[model samples]
Target: MNASLESTMRVKSSTEKDFLKLSGVNAVDVGYKYVDGKRTDEICIRVHVTKKKKTVYKKEMIPAEIDGIKTDVLEGTYVPQMLSPKAIDELLSDTVKYRPLKGGISIGPDRSVGGNIFTGTLGCMVTDVATGKPLMLSNYHVMCIDNGWHVGDQMNQPSLIDMGTHADGAGTLLRAVLSSHVDGAVASINSGINSSAAIVDIGNVAGTATALLGDAVRKRGRTTLLTYGFVDGLNGTVNIDYGDGIGVKTLTSQILIRPDTTINPRFSNSGDSGSTIVNGDDKVIGLLFAGSSSAPFLTIANPIGFVETELAVFIEAGLQPNLSKGGLENE
Candidate 1:
């Protein structure tokens, strides 16, 4: 971590709880702040208050500096809204078939009924470290029915959202790890189903790369198609709203992507969750999961290295040929 970021995080960790205890503070993080028209890194605290509530807390309740690091207090109404799936699978004709399965396509859990009605993106193809079998990767919320799924559940391509009814079954949930820093899961691709390790728009991912501040990256998702951005934050923490009763889950050590304003105003949007983030060389960097809804939208992702270690799988490179035992050839 850079000196500025390290100092900012130290302040965040030491004072986050104190900030949150205040009536209007909803979230806290480390980000850039404009000081004298120059961008300076600092600890950012989000204070959400209605026009009426703002009067209750005195200015002293929010500090302008903590531990000598500049503190930014952003005042806005912070409503905790639930996050819904963004991928809206285009309905295809019953006769229309997806010839080759690849990353950046629709997929979802196979329930007894209405399995294909909802869908998420297929992140990429990877090899299971234990079984050496080629498996498809995606968010647990996308493939596991948002934590209600079980092992051996059927998964389908072109998901139900794309009209992939029971007849279009494609794979089975192999393993899942949703209760951690990442919302990830994998499924075993079924026999005779063709799949490619390459991502859409972006070509084959040669390998994995460590995320660095200011690195250029891009991803192809089911919703927004292909978009590019730059890594703006590291070792970051975020709170994600999983709905009313589910509340929020705190994710740590996350990579934050800000849209390249010079190119596009946005990076990823709804339904783009589970897309793989890769660098200019097409090397994997992170797995995209969430984004901010407001302007200067930011995309959040789990570092690819962390995801691989947590899931015990290796993202496959190039095209993967069908193996009788369902294993990738090079592995």
Candidate 2:
């Protein structure tokens, strides 16, 4: 790491509280500075806000530079990327049941409280380190709708939100972790449901890796399908609304992504949660969980390393089932 970047990170940590207290501020992180809409080599402290106001109170104004470290303000309001009832209703026609269920497709809890339906992407397939049982990965919010859900709660592909009452049974929740850093969960694949190791559009993952700043990445999600992006910020601390009793959560050490304009305009959208983000080499890097409402959408993910450690699962060295006939194949 460059000396200047290290210094900027330190300053960002020391002054994060004061910056977040400012009205409209949503997150704080370290990233390259941008000038005239183009990325610059200079590293700076990034202050993400829900809205970039034309003017603000003198006390709430963010300095151009903090401790001689440059600061950039970005517009963003992060929220869990689960499909809403309105979206589900509109996308009902797009839902399709997969025989050999695989990554990048829609999945959700068997049901939601009060008959509500929800949908999120099935990230990928992995094996439990302790039990060696096959499991599908997703988000805690996607698998465990609320505190009422337990470890054995059933999950469905195409999701109840997408397929209504016709959704088929898929897996059962095995473990989940919602903490200061990660929002991840895994479900044991039930009998008769064949799952593939490869993501829908992306090929078999090479393995896990640390997501570095500016690394080109992509994800196959339920709503967005396959979209390209790049890591723009690291070690981000942001506030996310998980809805209802779960409420707003403060997530730390997040990987921040910005859309790759040359390819896709939006890297993620609602129902993209639980998508696995991989680097150019098809190496798993992060787990998509939340994103901002910004133009092109600013995707947020927990580092894949953190998700693996927290969930006690190994993704890269796990399953290697052959893709079914007429199924996705790695290039």
Cα deviation of 201, candidate 1, in Å: 0.6
Task: Tell me, by lDDT, which candidate is best.
Answer: 2
**Consecutive 10-residue window with the lowest summed lDDT within model 1:** 76-85
- Residue pairs in steric clash, candidate 2? none
Measured against the true structure, the TM-scores of the candidates, in listed sequence, are 0.81, 0.93
What total of clashing residue pairs does each candidate reach? 4, 0
User: Per-residue lDDT tens digits of candidate 1, residues 279-317?
Assistant: 887889998887766655678788888889888999766
Put down candidate 2 lDDT per residue, 116-213, tens digits, no spaces. 77888899998789998768999998888666778888888778877635447887899999998899999997676667888887868888899988
Q: Candidate 1 lDDT (Cα, whole model)?
A: 0.68
TM-score of candidate 1 to 2 decimals: 0.81
**What is each predicted model's overall lDDT from 0 to 1?**
0.68, 0.84
lDDT of 1 at 91: 23
